[model samples]
Target: MPELIFRQPDGSTQLVSAENGSSVMQAAIRANVRGIEAECGGACACATCHVYIAPSDLLLIPAAKEEEEDMLDGVCAERREGSRLACQITVTDALGDMIIDIPDRQY
Candidate 1:
């Protein structure tokens, strides 16, 4: 299992093990991680699972697809260089111990 570190808005951190082939949003939901609402259940239909990837980790994952990019535009928080939808990020061994920051808002 690969672990992911989630940084919440309140400055707390959570480390959760995510199985390979699952999305970050799924792992967050399964682990009851605060700040990751995941309202659409990893369907990519909503932007509530928005997170910010660290610059170092950004190079490890694929760029957001067009649909995901479109959804990001509507994110409640300010879109940033590393902004991404957690539902679009697949967990793999190569992404070991990656850190993701939950935006201040997910509405």
Candidate 2:
């Protein structure tokens, strides 16, 4: 398992263990983390799992594909350079202790 640190907009952090090969959204959902809805069930079909990659951990994750990029644009919160679809990030040792910030909303 890998560790995931989720940052809330108010500056608090929630740590959760992420199962290997599961998407970040799945990890959050399983942990009952409040920010990730994963409405599309890791299919990249929706933007409900939108998140912002912490710059320090950005390179540790994979680049987003075109479909994910398009989906991200629909995220309810304002987007940033680090915006990504959490459903696309599969956990791995390389992503250990990976940190991400949840947007204000997922709709």
**Which candidate wins on lDDT?**
1
C-alpha displacement of 49 in model 2, angstroms?
A: 0.3
Give the poorly placed runs of model 1, Cα more than 4 Å off.
none
Reference-based lDDT, each prediction:
0.92, 0.87
Candidate 1 lDDT by residue in tens digits, 1-107: 99999998788899999999999999999999988888888888889999999887899999999999999999999899999999999999987789899899887
Q: What's each prediction's TM-score? A: 0.96, 0.94
Model 1's alpha-carbon lDDT is: 0.92
How many steric overlaps does candidate 1 have?
0
Residue 72's C-alpha lDDT in candidate 2? 77
